[model samples]
Target: MPSSLARCVLSCALSAAALAIPVMSAQSAAAEVVPMPPHEKTFASPDGPTFVVGSEGESINKVPPLNASGTVREVFISGSSYTRSDAPSGGTLAVGYHVGCAVELQGGNVGVGPNAYLNPGLLDQEDIGPVVSINVGPGSVSDVPLLTKEVVSGVPARIMMRDIHLVVNGCIGPAVVRQYTLMQLHTDSLDDIGVVYGDPLWI
Candidate 1:
């Protein structure tokens, strides 16, 4: 019933509207399906140990024992601290960064010690539990200590580390003080060191 020009215009308008509907729907669907980034999602999920700041200002973390057949190939730690001393002779204080773990050996399951695991004395078949009391340098986080041999391996073991600060008093001057922060650890078995430090990506 419409004239030729009017009919042509109407048909074009209907076709344009039909095309726009699909585009709009697709856009809406995309918006609704927005996904979080991989790293963010991984951090949001609880797949490993949880760290909490202790009353003494140390970063304390507890991890479940490794699986039955799992083994730890390496251990590493890094951190930073600030030291102030008023004495004429600079006094040295040893701060312990503790890491405790269960070690499976020929005899039986035993707890790891500073000189026992990750050192030169023994080779643990499987390292489990928590390893603690590793010492870190003062005022810098750039140093990372990695241990390849004499570490626990092969069986299930829990792992734990505590951050610590040691301050030595200067005999001749004011008070000596040391503060440690931003401590972190890593191992071949666990790539996400941030989990040990309590921050997902190291704050």
Candidate 2:
């Protein structure tokens, strides 16, 4: 990593330092606290769901509440996810720090994030057809392959999916990136915003 890129990565982590308040160690959370990351941001496009960098505090935008009519795409955080104070409709939350991750939802079923589904962070969805991993930014590991439970709309990068494993542990090498490239995850289900499960080894 160049001096400039390394600084960016460190700055990203700084945003989420507060959310480290504490870790939720239960299989399911009763009154979940959706901690915000220090960093807040969006992807290249502004139409689709915003790609929140590191959500340090609650959400800044309250538009299109959670589980609304239109579908929502976000990386699934185990303990907490895109939600506010209580109830799913309050507001959306993301860890903000270390880059905001997301999951693709079918619109109505806006249940808790993957942390609501599985306990162990890294779920290995097997027998996948070959998940395509693309980087949208720094510190992203597009390893696990995923499929959407709903039909993804819009262009490839903006599309989201279901039935895919969202991995966060990312590593980079001098050989892989020849330029200043951001990683993105994509597959047949969607275009640029692809979902793929990654390996623990990447950690």
Candidate 3:
């Protein structure tokens, strides 16, 4: 049998070891539960525009909005106007016209044209696309290549139409167009919209 002094030391040592067991187990469990960060990449369009897409962040499935300012390089009618008569008696006629324009940034990059479509029903939907706010200036339609003072001042403009599709004519082949919107409000910057996790732990 051990002496009382030795027995007391042994008992204390065992108690300390027992206390340490729970702490070590807790740390191990925490390590196992924590998830790893996601991968990311930056994508650019042929017209010298760029955006980020990745497994993380608010714009995971959708393209974020872009802010660009530059001089107008070219403006032309990319599509023909559609005309429809109200009745056989040659009543009022409705016309739908399409236009195309490009802007040359002060830094020499080009903003091809602004085009976009809106789906009001998709407001609460998920995994569809990003929502963006667009702003244009007065006389924007007529003031191509020559930006008005309002536009230069960055005044939020309005969108006259939605679900717009403009067909470009006389290109090497069917060209890819980047769509954007024009409105009065601005969207939050990319940095302000932080990363978002969307996958299972095992993934």
Candidate 4:
């Protein structure tokens, strides 16, 4: 009888261990971190300077906020942008991200509410600074600037950003985010604007 009872206990323990395996695997999959592929683009104006921009980053989907229905994501994007002009003068370059949810942002339909106010002072800043967080609802979009600075001709400006903790409240479903680089070249004859866009990532 003693040997029989020991065998029974051993069988129950193995059964419990087997049941726990799937749960553990599910939890591990939920916390997985993924590295996004690097993206780059180049834009040139007619008889003007050429602008090149690139971004490399990674992202992780974290647990949602307490008592909230949305998800929280940790994202990091590093961008390098430069301008080349032979007209003796360079231009200003601005780098930022276009974050959206459930909307086709690539179709050029970014809906900003009437009450939304974008800080004008961001344009005047010469350093990479954090922009104010915007609450994006379903089917909405927001622009988050990571950095902006002046770029000299034939010189490159590198902006490194990491550990960006974004709490997307009230946002349901998957979210999409992409980086944009805009440069304004001031030449002797024409002041032209060039833009480069990074590949979109679904987070």
Highest-lDDT candidate: 4
Q: What is the descending TM-score order?
A: 4, 3, 1, 2
How far residue 192's Cα lies from its native spot in candidate 4, in Å, is: 2.1
TM values, all candidates: 0.21, 0.17, 0.22, 0.60
Model 2 whole-model lDDT (C-alpha atoms): 0.25
Which residue window of length 10 is worst by lDDT in model 1? Answer: 33-42
lDDT of 1 by residue, 159-196 (tens): 22222111111111211112222212223344222222
Model 2 weakest 10-residue run by lDDT:
174-183
Off by over 4 Å in 4: 1-29, 57-87, 103-132
Task: Score candidate 2 by TM-score against the native.
Answer: 0.17
lDDT of 2 by residue, 1-203 (tens): 56988998888787666444443322123223333233223343222332322211222111221232222222322211221111111111111112222322111111134324322222232223222222334433222212212222232211122222232222222112100112232332333331111111101
Question: In candidate 3, residue 60 scores what lDDT?
Answer: 14
Candidate 1 error regions (>4 Å): 32-50, 53-203
Assess each prediction's global lDDT (C-alpha) against the native: 0.27, 0.25, 0.25, 0.57
- Residue 194 displacement (Å), model 2: 10
RMSD (CA, angstroms), candidate 1 = 23.3
- Listed per candidate, the RMSD to the true structure in angstroms reads 23.3, 21.1, 24.0, 7.7
As for model 2, its CA RMSD to the true structure in angstroms is 21.1
Ten consecutive residues with minimal summed lDDT in candidate 4? 104-113
- Which scores greater on TM-score, model 2 or model 4? 4
